[model samples]
Target: MRIIHLLVIGALVFAAAYVYRIKMDSTARTERVLRLHAEIREQRDAIAVLRSEWAKLDAPLRLQGLAERHLPLKPLNATQYDSLKNLPERPPSLVRPGDPDPIGAMIQTIDASADASSVTGSVPTSAPASEGQQ
Candidate 1:
């Protein structure tokens, strides 16, 4: 009976030690979590301050003032505007009169082939002229 009592006491002491260790670990983890949360809040506040400063720097009035002081640009005037009719006519094509347009020929061939394929109830699987010729 005395041996049984000693064994029981030993088991109880070990259990108490284990429980105390677990409680200490839980407390340390909780402190770390709180520290990390504080760091995150500080970073968020810094970011908000930076964003506000950026907004102030990027205001349109500030940009206009900076541009007027540093750049050689002038504001628009009523006399600067022109009527569309006053624009000159387009220049002639650069291609010679006798030269054939490869693009136009390819487009026509593709259109004709597509029409023929539709009439025959079959799709044309051939590659485009530009790719085939290459």
Candidate 2:
């Protein structure tokens, strides 16, 4: 009977200890959850405050005044805007057939001859004075 009583006491002590350990673990988890919730709330509030401050800093009137102070710009009146709507069309010049520009053609010929002479080690004659003058 005494051995049975000791066994019952040991079981009761173990149960009490298990309950104490479980309570401690649950309390630690609850504290961690509460801390995370508080951090989330703080971050949310900070974002809202930053958004409100950004909106105030980006107001349109302030932006226009800033532009006027820094840029070479002015508010457009209707008369100035109307002038762009009625400009006359310019007629294109006609190019005559077989009428290549003589000076440009001579320059291209001279450049080609220079390249050929440089590779072949000989001097190429330039267009004579008569051809040049024409």
The best candidate by lDDT is 1
- Candidate 1's TM-score reads 0.57
Local accuracy of candidate 1 as per-residue lDDT tens digits, 1-113 = 99999999999999999999999999999999999999999999999999999999999999999999999998789999899999999999876777767677876576676
- Candidate 1 Cα errors over 4 Å, as ranges: 76-134
lDDT tens digits by residue: candidate 2, 1-134: 99999999999999999999999999999999999999999999999999998998899998888898999996778776546558767777465556767776786676676645354333335544346435
CA lDDT scores, all candidates in order: 0.84, 0.79
Worst 10 residues of 1 by lDDT: 116-125
- Residue 69 in candidate 2, Cα distance off native in Å: 2.1
Residue 7 miss distance in model 2 (angstroms): 1.7
TM per candidate comes to 0.57, 0.52
> Model 2: how large is the Cα RMSD against the reference?
19.7
